[model samples]
Target chain A: MNNKNSGGSEAEDLAKAEMVRLLSIVGRDRSADAFEAIFRFYAPRIRSFMAAKTKDRQAAEELMQETMTAVWNKAGQFDPARGNVSAWIYTIARNVRIDAYRRKRPEFDMNDPAFVADDVAPADQEFQQIQEAQLLRGAMATLPEEQLDVLRRAFFDEASHSTIARDLGVPLGTVKSRIRLAFEKLRSSLEGRL
Target chain B: MNVKHHLSDEFLIEYAAGSLSEGWSLAVASHLALCPECRQRLHAMEGAAGALLDKADESANEDEAWARFKARAADIKVEEVKLEAPKATKQTVVLPEPLRSYVGGDLADLKWRALGRGAYQILIETKDKNTQVRLLRIPAGKPVPEHTHEGRELTLVLAGSFHDGEELFARGDIEEADGDLLHTPKATEGEDCICLAVTEAPLKFSSWIVRLVQPILKI
Candidate 1:
């Protein structure tokens, strides 16, 4: 049921909560059954996600395995209270794909000596992370068709903005403005909540 | 006050989706380290991207794939303390992570090479052949080489300030200059300006002296 068009339904919430429990079981007891359940669901999704960005099926398979292995190993890191399972798993898949396909995408280490900490309290940050993903998914269904199309491509396609503009056959300015407008709309919709 | 300049929504979306190459990722990650406002926006962008995963078409799957994965399941090395990496870096007190690893230490650790006219640079090695990432230091009150970029140029002001035409970019401000835009960046008086600059393709140096030295220094 890939009902991305719908807002947060009770069934969707239950499924997400169940996956969170399964992920925690894998994290806690290294349960093969739980891990397989996740693998069956997410592996296909990750493969299709990778297929959109790059056509290398073998590589997608390789990275898909890597993503699952990471889930098995890093499941303990997932916190149900902080965020939903999809956001957490997608973040992992994104990193795995980048490291394998595009080389090392260095990130800001919070443990670094000079790293600046967000002024927001940890409790509040966790609350936002939990609420925002659910809220944004609902908001996304409401985005204008053109804006959503470009935003989806921006997420899935590795192509740069200029390349996107060329393919869309629109002015580069139009592409940029559409993206800006899309994010603005999403931001405005979630203003009081986020 | 927040950093005056920020990465556009386009950059954040690409970066958040894990589509940017190594060099551009470096610029964006380093900027996120200094700018919290962008960090919040990045988190939101990531949430939106995660939502898109729901729409991906599910392909045919084989039990053999699960079998193959199960073959390697025993080797799983669960993280001991969640996402925390080893706190082994001793002198990262100056630069942020991932960049700190690239630099091998903090700000005091950099060994700058002179680039004439009181400017200096250290080219950082990155895997992407299409882009060159470097740390550039322009002395206070000195003008840098005016450049006509053959490709995009991403500059993140790490310390001090630089004026490109009318805009003054201070620490934490990032500027993505591309297309037909030409700039002559002059460091403001009072402090030496140090920044992380990522350039795609070789830039055309306008000053004859700097142009002559450009070949040798490979700026």
Candidate 2:
């Protein structure tokens, strides 16, 4: 167990380092080699993500391509100090999917009054986000399997509380409480640190 | 601003997941502009989503997808435009970031149409057919007719305060009401209450006279 834990942390460090290198090369020089490496690493994963949402192989592939194209175009905006590379990429994927849906219904203009540019925390807050993220990951690992299962369904599938409760064969309140408990734990774990 | 109420976790999750309706997302985004705590929470949720993406199973068409993507990337011209910082607009009523770009001017610039009984409203046009958003300015000590929502209604107090027979909502407080809630909200005596209200469907006013004019009001 100790060896496994250390190995997991070592993998995380390596992944973080790779992401930093990729962002620097893409942002500074627009290097094709770094772009190729990022494409190979993220394309399959992003395709899987789109597949889960669209459930159509052709549509998923189209969205995956669009998302990667966005990454290449917006590489200069990627600030590792603001958020982790994976989170930044995930946001791009999510927005691309949403934009695809919005395109189908042409009436919905993306430049509507209610829309606002996303806020990027100051550089000073970067350490707090990174530290909080690590703490959250550790907190997530300690959650009970059942709680984690519900959270995973909620986050990945975008399942509503009622839907998760129905799927798990539990009362609605139980599902809500489980989610609340999980968040409470995460918040408490990183309370003083933040 | 010391914001007391905030966007709920459910709403934040929906926003982060991109599952929220355009109208509702706008309300949340407006609130997010005013509340740093909620923004931090949203960032954490995004981090959680990213962690899940890291662990998700990979697809089979990785090689083919990469090849096609590479071919497409070669033809695209990536712009190197730098994002400009938002300029501070000198206005009497300082609008928050989300609303600032929409109004383009201060409170005086809005072409407010008088809603009967001293309440003025400006209907903001949105592309979403399912949801309608409006800015309502209630004169001090005036009461909105008792009403029940047909669908969900989210009201954010942009300026001043109002009492909905139960709680006092000040600036930056968001009150979420659904079909089940029915109440008459009145502006407090000290100042006029200005609210940003988003509704999925038109409201059901309690008074017969108000209902008769509801079609004309288009609230």
Candidate 3:
């Protein structure tokens, strides 16, 4: 309803468009500079991505590199017609990080054979990640602003109920209930589309 | 192949966080193949994971990280490998008869093997060595050896019942456990006890021989 929100959505759309264009070139021609550009753009950013879950810098670097290699190998699979490239690459990095974490610790076997194969890249797997992200983003646009913000803070910021309550000037119980209700609504809204 | 045993938001978050066990992770993947809802949740979690990964410290990098990675990439001309191996796709993923009856659709058939007393293994289809997914079925009335979780365990009860400490699991109940808890579960009475267990590590059997056999068994 406000200019700022509209501008934010527009910016996201533009980013998505640029990502699609770059991915298209990468997919068709491995030699294209698009790959290099993407590498440069995301490589630094991906380091921090890994660091959030783990404290080790060496491990984060390893996962970041693995994530980039996937981008290079799976560039051809990106379909601009479906969704944005950021979501696709993000999904790839996410899975690579998960795999890297698994390899570092020798615990029990929780490997997904579907994901473990040497050749099956993230691009080759279902494209649902990007689609879901897109759908959730769209669904998020439909929610009441207060509920949407509460869900984002609770899940994304990992804010505690008390912290969110104090910050938002609401009771801790209200914050907790709002987040729970918001998640339930989100689940119901996206349940069928997923 | 139990549609009813869909991965939940909590499980998806843990999976994205890389906190799930190997066996349980495999089961979730199989479930993902059948349920798009879970897959979608995973994708969203992937985004959140990206944000999480983005928060890491920026000052450090592995000394040989780029060189090692480049060497590995140069060694292989990575291309489109289908998501499912032929064997994985070909194997009729045998579900609990009740679950099988509910699916009413084509399923990935899998090879099932017995893993000592009370324990059984089902080879779920996977795409690579890195993406290992399998199904471990512990039949009714049998209790696993008391053990600490190797990594993160995501257990979704497909049918029957199992108990860990004071809690009991029935159909569709999900339990997420990790190294923090050491416990044993026995299937409840009158049910064959079907469950979808996903984990990133093989169970560390208390017996030394079981550990030795683990490498050979390739579980």
Which sections of candidate 2 miss by over 4 Å?
Answer: A1-8, A103-123, A145-155, A160-172, A192-194, B59-61, B89-93, B100-104
Span of ten consecutive residues with least summed lDDT in model 2 chain A: A103-112
Which DockQ values do the candidates obtain, in the order shown?
0.55, 0.35, 0.14
In terms of DockQ, which candidate is strongest? 1
Recovery fraction of native interface contacts for candidate 2: 0.32
Give the higher-DockQ candidate: 2 or 3: 2
The residue-by-residue lDDT of candidate 2 on A137-164, one tens digit each, is 6666777888878777876566778888
| Runs with alpha carbons beyond 4 Å of true place in candidate 1 | A1-6, A54-59, B59-64, B75-79, B82-92
Rank by lDDT (best first): 1, 2, 3
Compose the digit string of candidate 3's lDDT tens values, residues A1-194: 21232222655555655777887887787653576556655766777666655667677677888788888888877766555565577667756765654442122112322211233356734464444444455545566768756554543344555666898999977865664565565555545453
Question: Of the candidates shown, which would achieve the greatest lDDT relative to the real structure?
Answer: 1
Residue-wise C-alpha lDDT for candidate 1, range A127-156, written one tens digit per residue: 776666667777887888888788777777
Score residue A176 of candidate 1 by CA lDDT.
93
- DockQ score, prediction 2: 0.35
* CA lDDT scores, all candidates in order: 0.80, 0.75, 0.57
Candidate 3 local accuracy as lDDT?
0.57
In order, the candidates keep a fraction of the true contacts of: 0.65, 0.32, 0.13
Sequence-dependent TM-score of model 3: 0.53
| TM-score per model over all chains | 0.89, 0.87, 0.53
